[model samples]
Target chain A: MAASATRADALVHARGLTKRFDKLVAVDAIDFDVQRGEAFGFLGPNGAGKTSTMRMIGCVSSPSGGELRVLGLDPVIDGPRIRARLGVVPQADTLDMELRVDENLLTYARYFDIPRDVARARTQELLEFVQLKDRAKDEVEPLSGGMKRRLTIARALVNEPGLLLLDEPTTGLDPQARHLVWDRLYRLKQQGVTIVLTTHYMDEAEQLCDRLVVMDKAKIVASGSPRSLIDQYSTREVLELRFPIDAAPALDGKLDGIAERVEVLPDRVLLYAHDGEAAASAVHQRGLRPESTLVRRSTLEDVFLRLTGRSLIE
Target chain B: MTGALRVVEHHLMVYRRTWKGGMFVSFASPILFLAAIGIGLGSLIARGPVHTVGGVSYLTFLAPGLLAATAMQTAFVETTYPVMAKIQWLRTYDGMLATPLTVRDVLGGEIGWLVIRLATTAFAFFLVMVLFGTVHSLVALLMIPVVVLNGLAFGAPIFAFTATQRKDKGFPTIGRFIITPLFLLGGVFFPIAQLPPIAQGIAWATPLAHSVVLSRSLAIGGMNPSALIDVAVLAAYATLGIIAASITLPRRLVR
Candidate 1:
């Protein structure tokens, strides 16, 4: 009966899902679907309702209105059953500071009623998977931030959940640490685990998410594959020009005909075109002597800015 | 129910990692109090006109009072800073809820662990009383249950209160204002009969005072039917605390 109530093809199905806190609306009416074995994401800046939506899907926070079904079970009614099969990594590291790293996973496995011997075996394998095998006996307090994040990921996998939900999986890590986490998540996806993550990093979304929704101000402005979203909202390449002062807006009129769309930011002027080199040459021909110019391929950042008129990171 | 037991297992693991200092503090504090106040003051009181309290030595009278007080203090302490850490700073409860456990299971498991702590601490204190020649009858073993009830009467309410707190600022206030006052004046050091009538009435209303009365009666082999009323009061307090925790903990954790 629960399966009959939801779309059986998708692991998560939300229709006009909303979350309200008193008078403030954290997540407005929005809709999306997450297919199994795919890496789906909610890409937005801070205060863009990404965490709220993830919490709703994680069954930690109840939605204020509309419909939400996770793993074909209603979150409000079948929360514990749904949660038993779902893994969640919150925005903050909630690891036990007093216990050793391995104990963290072992105790969490008990919450799911996993037997002791099996839990121990899984703990060893998860620590090895997260590259924290050496630190299994070490207390969690002194480990680095990246190590803590990886341990948290390992803890989430102790139950062998089918759907993994990570809220801001790599928000506060160095480039090396971010790549390490992404590598682990990619392996999980390959093993047929459906991954749902929320992040503000456009590069993270591009690298890990097979498909994503662009959320801004409590609503999803766009949703598609990364390449398709970029193609629909942005050009193939972008020409960036910077000036000492805020002169990009003044030169927006002159930079018009060279690119498909011209975006004049406070510090830099962006020209979206198929040939960034040609656009840069056209800017030189217009006698606009800028301090610097660079050409790069269009990224999800370009698509976000084009859709929301704001950068992905504030 | 199994989910709640899992929470108990989690706390046991936490206790296993840091049990040395905690065990020493729990066992040593009651013995230290018995030595300093029970024996030290019992000697001076023996020299006075009223040498015995309730037809026994002062040390005997004070031993059961301290037993009940130890239960109350241990319960209050366990539910305050530790509960606050699990709610806010450490986020252990959030981590638990992310699993198959519900808010009820988490809170139930926490109170269950509190009961275990109360039982162990009470039994240890009761042993010290026996070594001191304080137990006068076979019914003295029943003090363990009375002591545990006294603990839940305090631990449950404090656990509920701690769940609703956003910061730990109010914790010290509860310790200073409510717990300290009850420890000092609620039939611990001296009989509430020595106080004025109004003070006696207030003391009788407190769970510690009832537990102290029941514990003293059991230790001295006095079979008073009024002990049933004392049991009812302690039971009511424990039940009410569980109810309040059920209401507040979910609001804090599942939001």
Candidate 2:
């Protein structure tokens, strides 16, 4: 991409961007830079400032303290100018349910000052682009959840935005719906649109992100690619053992030397190891084979668990 | 404020699909009301000792007042729920803000659309008044602008108030307590002189009273120098409404 030659190859640059609402500090001082044509993900649990950061990047909210620059323009000074070239998918579906599917697209284009004919043509192309062409004449209220999401994505693409900021693009979607949304987003990334997304789903970050920053308690805890984060923070494999609750706590001592680290929970125990089969065999060698066991490769979820000391989903 | 007109343009597009729902209030309600009030109620008034009011038929005297009042009604209706829906329910304003539009542009588009709605419905009411032979002079054509002003006078403040609402329980009170009294007692059915002096003083402070006086004089043949006072009063209210909306809407939306 020609963006590599630009003066500021970073399309988004932030340093200590902070947002506070009264007594609560929603976003603590956090800094990150997103390069052009890169698909960056903010992976975090709720209340970790993912959505707040997205809003700041979208130019819809002002920073209470610190600096934020989108496309090299200060959001406070050039909000509208910067927003004209961006697309945002909010966490909730805010589609105009009263209008037909196509009207929502056309209305959005008008906000960018696109002429009527040009808007109509673009609306047509976008409806087809999101695979909602057949439902263009339908009311927005009745479309399925996934279809509504696709239509929103299409509406965002209507302006041909250089940067697309999606806040949990697949939060409420089913697995099938989530995959399709991810597919369309991947296609946009392949088309060279700079994309920044926020998600709590570690697999989503691993599946789609070229680079990711794990955020927690309003601060970034870890930042790197999925493999690098795992390699940096977690063992290559994890062994899971589920004993009856009465027997689970006592087995921790038996499996002490089997793996590098052990995580004890009420229902199961996680054994972090470089080789899962050898670790499970080590458990048997200690005469502690009273439960079921399984081995799996470490993922971003493990990396998150290692960093935050809490499960990603729970 | 660049691309502010697109906000109104966005509304116009939505109105194309949704205006039918509002037709009862905008077009049909006025015709039904004029027929019921001017023709039906005026017949009873004509039988009384004072058959003529202000040297004209009772129905003719009442037509301009109702037209101006209807303008206020339509403006209130257009500005209140639509603004509330955009801000709270439908979040259309949020949708616009996510684009290049700002909160001020959204407010401008909203108030601008309310003005057009007031004009269209007022024009429809004028035709209904003509059908009942309530229009007495050709200058009645100017009632459109006066009606638009009256609607804006009410719409602007309502927009300001509605933007600050988190729930809709207060909306019904506005219709019942504020708009209803203005419709009934703000000189819509009779001259404020018929009331006692204190009541008359209170009526003079209202936008509907000033709007009614301006509209009635414009519809009839005699609009004297005092009509300027009515214009100034109504214009002041409209300006206040705009100022208040600009302040409150951004405070509500930007947060």
Candidate 3:
């Protein structure tokens, strides 16, 4: 009966999900669905309600209003049941400082009622999977930031959860560390684990999320695959021209016929057009002298800027 | 209740890593204090101001009092800093909740571990009492669980109070204002009856004073059925502390 009611394949289904804290509406009437075995994402700026929505889906925070079902179970009624099948990696590293790396995973497995021997076996396997086997005996306090994040990821996988929720998985790491985590997540995706992550990095969203929702100010402003969102909201390419303060004119009026849209910034002018090369030549033909010029294909950053008119990172 | 034992198991694993470091401090400090106060002062206390307290040597009278005090200090130490650490610093409880465990299980397990630690510390202190010839009868062996209850009388409420705090600055305040005063005035060093009549009323009201009365009664083979009231007081504290923790821990952790 439960499977016959909602979408049989939808692991997480939310309709008009609202989360308010006192007078502040952190997540206001947002709606989305997460399908099984897909790498889904929630993309938004800071304070844009990304973490609030993830907490709701994680079954730790009950919604203020509206409907939310995770894995065909009511979040408020069967929170523990829903949580048993879901793995969560919070935004911050919550690893035990006193316990060793392997002890962290082993202690967590006991909460799920796993057998002691089975939990130990899984701990060993997960430590190897996250490439932390060498540091299994080391305390969590001494490991580097990236190593701690990997250990946290390993700890989340101790139960072999079907749906994994990652909230800002790599927010404070360098480029090398971020890629290492991305590589591990991509492998998990290939193995058919449903992944829902929240990130502000366009490249991270583009590289990992098969589909995503862009939220701004507690509402879903746009939702689609990264490629389709870029195509729907922006032109094919963007021609950037940085000119001296005095040389640049009323660029919107001056470059009217060259591109579909023109946005002027203090340091540069963006000419949105289907043919960036053509737009650049048109600017040269008009005898407009600029300091520098570059043409590139439209990216998720462009789509985000067009939708919210603010950068993803503050 | 379902997964409370698992929570205890988790704490046991963490304790395994650091137990050896605290071995000397857990047993040796209490032994030294018993020696200095029980023997050093027992000599002076033997001849001075009304010798033969409760018709026994001064060391024997103060031995049971030290047992109760040891239980109180052990409970406070085990519950306060560790509870605050798991709530704010280590974040281990948050990790547990992400699994199948609920807030109730976590709290139950933590208090359970505190009780076990109190028992072990009391056992070590009991050995020291024996070396000094303070154990007078077979009834003294029953005070192990009694000491655990006495510790919980303080440990449970302190754990509940520490769970609600945002910072650890209040911990030292509790030590200075609440714990220290209880140690000084709660009939640990001398009989509460020796104090002014008004001070005697206040001492009898403290949880430590109740435990001291019960332990000393049992140790010297002088217990009567009326001693059940002392057990009732400690049990009430443990129950109330558990209830308060169940209510307040989820508010701070789940949201």
Model 3 B-chain TM: 0.95
Q: For model 2, what is the alpha-carbon lDDT of residue A152?
A: 90
Error of 2 at A42 (Å): 0.4
- The TM-score obtained for chain B by all candidates, in the order given, is 0.97, 0.95, 0.95
Candidates by DockQ, descending order: 1, 2, 3
**TM-score, candidate number 1:** 0.97
True contacts kept of each: 0.91, 0.83, 0.83
For this target, which candidate reaches the highest TM-score against the unseen true structure?
1
Task: Quote fnat for model 2.
Answer: 0.83
Q: Model 2 over residues A1-314: C-alpha lDDT tens digits?
A: 33234437788988899998888888999988888888999998888899989999999999999888899999999999999999989888789877899999998988898888999999999898888999989999888999999999998888999999999999988999999999999999999999999999988998899888999999999888888899999999999988876876566467767899998866778899999999988888888865699999998888888888887777
Model 2 Cα shift for residue A143 (angstroms): 0.8
- Model 3 per-residue lDDT tens digits across residues A195-223: 99999999999999998999999999999
Kindly list the per-residue Cα lDDT of model 1 for residues B10-86, writing each as its tens digit. 98999997878877877788788889988999999999999988788888989998999999999988999999999
How would you order the candidates by lDDT, starting with the best? 1, 3, 2
Candidates' C-alpha lDDT: 0.91, 0.86, 0.87
Q: Could you say which candidate leads in DockQ?
A: 1
**Residues A125-221, candidate 1, lDDT per residue (tens digit)?**
9999999999999999999889999999999999999999999998899899999999999999999999999999989999999999999999999
Worst ten-residue run, lDDT, model 3 chain A?
A1-10
Q: How good is the docking of model 1, as DockQ?
A: 0.85
